[model samples]
Target: MRVVHLLRKYNPAEWGGTETAIQRLFEGLRQHRVTSVTYAPSIGSSIAADPLTEAGFAVKRFRACVPVWGISTERKRQLIAVGGNLMSFDLIARLLREPNVALMHTHTLGRLGGIALTSARLRRIPSVVTIHGGFLDLPESMTNNFRNAHRGGLEWGKLFGALLRSRRLLKDADAVVTCNRKEAALLKEKQTCKRIVVQPHGVPTSLYRKDHRESAREAFPSIRDQRLLLAVGRIDPVKNQRWLVEQASGIFRRHPDAMLGLAGACTDEAYGESLKRKIDELGLRQRVFLTGGLPPGDPRLIGLFQSAEVIVLPSVSETFGLVILEAWAAGTTVISSRTSGALDLIQHGENGLLFDLGAPETLHQAVDCALLHPELKSRLAATGGRVASAEYDVTVLAGRMKYLYDQLIAEKNALRNSAG
Candidate 1:
C-alpha cells in the first residue's frame, strides 16, 4: 500500500514530540513493507537540515517560513497564516496529483489539516489525521492579537476562522487517531468524526538495553560521578522546564550530589535564554547541564537513560510522552507529571512515581524519594521494564498500526466499490 505521512517538519535535529512520533511511525510502516512517503517543509539555509532518508521512501519538500526571522510571537502568527493559505491551495493540489497515493496520514491539524482535507476531497484519497495536542483548546492569551488587529484581519474572527476550518478538516477525515484516551475523549467531545483510534507511540527496546550503560558513560565523562537526573524535550513554556528547575533546587538542597541533565534543542531562543538565566539566578549553573541535540544512536543518549537515578517529565500538557516508555525500557524508573498520557502507562508507586504538574514541591519530594529508596527504584524499574517490553515495544506497536491501516484501507475500498 502507498502511504504518505504529512508533517510540519521531519528533521530529527529539531527534536519535538511530533517529529519523534512521525519518525517512529515511518520506521514502523517500513518494517511492514509498505511504501511510505514523507512531505515536509524545506530546511532552508539555516543550520537545521532535513534528515529524511532516501533508501526507504520518497521525500517531498514544501517551502514554508519557519524557524526563520526567529520563531517569535509575531513570526509564529505570520507563519500560521501563510501556512494555512499556501497549504490549503498549493500544497493540497500537489499532493492530490501524486499517483498511487492511497492514504495520507497527517500528524497535525492546523494548516496541514486544511491541506489534508482539500486533498481528500479533490482526489477521493482516504486520509487520517492524528491529534498530537489540543490546539483548539489553547488558552486565549496565546492567540495572535496583533495580527487580528491588522487590516485584512478578521480580528476575533481569525481565531474562530482557524478553529472552524480545523473542525471542518477533522469532520472530513476518513479516520481520526489520537495518542491516548484523554485526547480521544476530547476529540469526540469537540468534533464529529466517523472513526477514532487510540494508538500510543512506541520505542525501540534494542536501542536501550542493559549492556549499553558502560559504553554510554564512557562517551560522556561528566556524568560518571554525578547522580544524574535526566529530562528530554523541547525547552519551551508548555514543557514547564522552569518547574523542573525549581524542583531540582529543592532536590539539590537535600542531596547536593545530584545533578540534572537536559537533552533536546530549544524551540524558542528567548525561552532557552530565560531558562539559562533562571539556572544562573538559582545558583544551579554548576549542577544543571543542557546538552544541545544528540543523535538517536549516540551512546551518551543511552547512557544518560541507563545511568540516571530517575527520568522526570514535568510537562503541563502532553498527549503522549514517548520518553517515559523509552526510559522504562532501559530499566530506569520514571517520575512524570500526572497530566501527561504517560499517566495511563505508569502506575504511581507501582511502576513509577507520579506528581501533580502544578506542584513543584511534590515533584521534588518524588525525586528525593526515588533517590533515597534504592529498592523502590529497582522494583519500579524492573516492573516498568517488563511492562514496556511486553506492551510498548516498537515491533508490537508496528503490528497494531499495520492492522489499523489495513482495516482503514479495506473500509475505504469497500465504500468506493459500493458507490460505484
Candidate 2:
C-alpha cells in the first residue's frame, strides 16, 4: 500500500515529538511494504538542502516564504520559532498531480490539511488527519499561552494559511485520528457522523533489553557522580520545563547529589531564555543541566534514558506521551502530569506514576516518593518494560495501521463502483 503524509513543517535539525513519532512509524511501515512520501514546507533555510534522503523517507519540501523578507523581527521570530503554519499552494498543486496515490494521511490541521482533504475528494480517495497536539482538553492558561505566544502584526502567512482554514479542515476531513481517546471524543463532538480513529504513538522495544548504565554514566561526566532525574522534550512553555526547575530545588534538598537533565531542542527561544533565567534565579546552575536537542537514534539519548533514575513528563498538554513509552522501553521508571495521555498509559503505582499538572508541589512530592523508594522504581521499570514490549512496539502498531489502510481503500473502491 502507498500513502502520502502532508505535514505543516518538518525540520530534522530541530526535531520534536511529532518528528520522532513519524520516523519510528516509518520503520515499521517499510517492513510492511508500505512506502510513505512526506511533503512539508521549508520554513527557513534551516531545512537540509536534500530533505528526502536526509529525512530517511521520500521527503519533498515546498517553499512557504522567503526568510527575513517583508516581515518585522518579532513576526520573523514567530514565523521561524514556533512556525507560522504557512501553506504552500505550490505543494498543494503538486500533491493533486501525484500519480497512484491510494490514500492521503495528514498530520497537520490548517490549510495544509484542507488541501489534502480537498484533493482526496477530487481524486475519489480517502484522507485522514491525525491530531498530534491536544487542544480540546487544554486548560485556559495553556490555551492562552498558545494564542499569546505567537500573537503579533505582519504575520500574513498565519492569517491566510492556518487560522482562516482550520474550521474548514475539521468540517471536511473524511476521518479524524487522534493519539489518545480524549482527543478522539472531542473530534466526535465536533463532527458526530465523521469517523474517528484512535491510534497511540509507539516506540522501539529493543532499547529495554539492557540498561547500558555504566557506559551512559561514563559518557556524560556531569551526571556520573550524581543521581540522574531526566525530563525529555522541547524547551517550551507548553512542555513545562520551568515548573520542573521550580520543583528541582526540593528534589535537590532530599538527594543533594542528584542532577536534573533537560534533553531536547530549544524550539521556543523566548521560553528557552526564560528557563535559563529561572534556573539561575533559583540557584540551580549546577543541579540542572540543559542539553540542546539531539536527533533520533542518538546514542546519547538512549544512554540518558537507560541511565536516568526516573523519566518525567510535565507537559501542559500532551495527547499521547510517546516519551513515557520510550522511558518504559529503556527500563526506566516513569512519571507524568495527569493529562489524558498520562492517565491512559500510567496506573498510579503500577506500570508508571502520575501527578497533578495544576499542583506544582505534587511534582516535588512524586520525586520524593521515588527517591526514597528503590523498590518502587525497580517494580515500575520491570513491569513497564514488559508492557511496552508486548503492546507498544512499533512493529505491532504498524499492523494495526495497515489494517486500517486496507479497510479505507476497500470502502473507497466499493463506493466508486456503486456510483458508476
Candidate 3:
C-alpha cells in the first residue's frame, strides 16, 4: 500500500524527536512492503541532504508560509521553525493531484494536518494523525510559550484553518495516534468517537549494538576521563537545556568527574544564546560541551550515548521521550523529568528514574541515586535494554502499524462495495 506521510517541518540539520521517529518508522514499514512517501514544507536555505530521500524514500517538498502579517521577518522565521501553524495551498493541490494513495498520515496538527485530512476525505481514503508533541496534556508554562510565539502578529490564516476544519482534525481523522497514554486519554475526553492508538516510538537496536566508546573518546578527548551526563534534544526552552545547565553546578559538587554534554541543533537562536550566557555565568565552560545537531544513528552520537553514565532529559514537556528509548538501546541509565512521556515509559526505580519538573531538587536527587550506586546503574541499563529489544523495536512496531493499515483499508473497501 502507498501511504503519504505529511510533515509541517523537516530539516535534517535541525533533527529532533519527530524527525528521528519518522525515519525509524519508515525503516520499519519497508519490511512490511509498504511504499512510503513523505510530504513536507521546503526548508528554504538548508543544503542538508534529505535523509529520507537518501534512504531511498520519495520525499516531496512544497512551499508553505507562516500565514501571519505585521510580524517581523525574524519573528516569522522563528514561528515557522518552532511549530508554526503553517498554511500551504501548494501542499493541498499536490495531495489532490497525487495518484494511488491508500492512506494519508499526518505527523503534525493545525492547518497542515487539516489539509491532509481534508484531502484524504475528498479522495475517500483513510487519514491518520499522530500527535508528536503534547497538546491536551502540555504544562501551563509550555502552553504559554506557544501562545506567546505569535502574540503580536496578525494571524491571517484563521480563515484557512476554518476552511480546512483544522480544529476538528482529531475528530475527523480515521485514526488518531499518540505516543503517550496521557495524551491519548486527554484526546479521548475531547473526541470520544475517535480511534486513539497509543504507540510508543521505536528504536533500531542493531546500530547501537557495537561498542563505539573508543570512537567517542577519540572524537572528543576532553570527555576521556570524565563521567558524561548527556542530554540529547533540541536546544529549546521546552527541551529545558538551560534548566539542565542550572543544575550542573550542584551535580558537579557530588560527582566531580561528571561532565555535561548537550547534543542537538539549536532551533531557537534566542534561547540558544541565553543558554550560552547561563553556562558562562555559572563557570561551567570547562565542564559542559555543546555538540551541535548530531544526525540519528551517527556512530559518534551512538558512541556518546554508550559513553554517558546517565542520559538526562530536563524537558518541560515531552509527549513521548524517544531519547529514553535510544539511551536504553545503547545500554545506559536514564534520569528524566516527570513529563507525560517519561512517566509512561519509566517505572520509576525499575528501568529509569523520573523526577518532577516543579521540584528541581528532585532531579539532582535522582542523578545522585544513579551516580552513587554502580550496581543500580548497571541493573537499570540492562533492564531498559531488554525492554527496548523486546517491546520497542522499530520492526515490531511496524508490523503492528501494518496490521492497522490493512484493517482500515479492508473496512473502507467493504463500505464501498455495500454502497455500490
**Which prediction has the highest TM-score against the true structure?**
3
Q: Point out where model 2 deviates above 4 Å.
A: 46-55, 65-71, 79-83, 146-166, 208-211
Sort order, TM-score high to low: 3, 2, 1
Question: Residue 32 CA error for candidate 2 (Å)?
Answer: 1.4
Name the best candidate (by lDDT).
Answer: 3
Worst 10 residues of 3 by lDDT: 43-52
Tens digit per residue, CA lDDT, model 2, 181-271 = 8877876776653577788888887754555666566667788867899999989887899998988887888788899999998887888
Candidate 3, position 221, lDDT: 79
| Candidate 1 accuracy as lDDT | 0.73
Q: lDDT of all predictions, in order shown?
A: 0.73, 0.78, 0.90
Work out candidate 1's RMSD over C-alphas. 3.9
Error of 3 at 392 (Å): 0.4
The TM-score between candidate 2 and the true structure equals: 0.92
Model 2 lowest lDDT segment of ten: 149-158
Candidate 1's C-alpha runs over 4 A off are: 46-51, 65-74, 77-89, 135-165
Assess the local accuracy of residue 363 in candidate 3 as a C-alpha lDDT between 0 and 100.
93
Per-residue CA lDDT of candidate 3, range 1-420, in tens? Answer: 899999989878788889999998999999999999999898778556667888899989999999888889988888888878999988888998989999999999999999999999889888888889878899897788788877877899999999999999988888888898898888878775358898888999988999998888888778998999999999998999998899899999989999999999999999999999999999999999899988888888899999999999999889899999999999999999988888888999999998887798899889999999999999999999999999998999988888888988888789888999
